[model samples]
Target: MHELQALGKQLVELPAKQLVDIPLSEKTRDAIVAARSFKHGAIRRQLQYIGSLMPKEDEDAIRIMLYKLQQPHKDEVRAFHQLEQWRDQLLLGDQDLLNELAIKFENFDRQHIRQLIRNAKKEQEQNKPPKSARLLFKYLTEMQGK
Candidate 1:
């Protein structure tokens, strides 16, 4: 019951746009919206009321939706890590990875990638800033859109 009340508090705190994505009954949704306008003890009572209504809901589904809303960038973070790995592999002279990238992206410019790799290598040896590495990552991100 305490957990359900806590989840209700989280629901009430969410913006209307995010709340819309959540599966909620009309009565519960109205209570949450009203709770937003409440003050002091009234909001607590409303949260308890919402909690009482939660047993009729699919709790797991609501939890999953809340997780997705709270961590919207989870997938994007994973993809960014993937791009960084690709950039690192290219810098390491992984020719097979390079060939794989070429086969994957139709607009993959082998010459441009090669040039960026060489510049990145030079920067690493000279202890300079990794300008080319950043550009390579940017290029890879653009390729993702195509």
Candidate 2:
């Protein structure tokens, strides 16, 4: 299992151009292009929703340094692939791996990450009938105990 703190630190240190790739799955890339082409607010909102799951850390400094590296470019699709490469290089592929690794360093394991990811996805997936922010916040607060 991956150390969440270590992963957080790495994410914080990564350049914005690199971070942009983090959310860029192949499907995400298609959605982004389709969104930009049509100014599709819904797609953009969905992308933003997925992006929201990422820990909002202080990577803004690195992004400022690498600001020019990212733009609405023709190779935006390539960025998606690059992001996938980074995910692989980051070695975040397997839940079991992360859990096993994390246990060596911390008490928490993949089950927690899986739960968090699952809940986040469920939150986004059930967009129409999702829990209110207050309830979500309550759940998140409870998760801290585990």
Query: Who wins the TM-score comparison?
Result: 1
Cα distance off (Å), candidate 2, residue 12: 26
TM-score of each: 0.68, 0.22
- Residue pairs in collision within model 1: none
lDDT of 1 at 98: 95
- Model 2 clash pairs are 1-97, 1-98, 1-99, 1-101, 2-98
Weakest lDDT window of 10 consecutive positions for candidate 1:
68-77
* Predicted candidate 1 versus true structure: per-residue lDDT over 40-145, tens digit per residue: 8999899999999988888999999999887867888988999999999999999999999999999999999999999999998999999999999999999987
lDDT tens digits, residues 1-146, model 2?
A: 13333333343444545756554345533433444334456644644543443234334553443444445443665655543443332233455645544554445444544564455456657884433333433433343335
CA lDDT scores, all candidates in order: 0.93, 0.44
Clashes of each: 0, 5
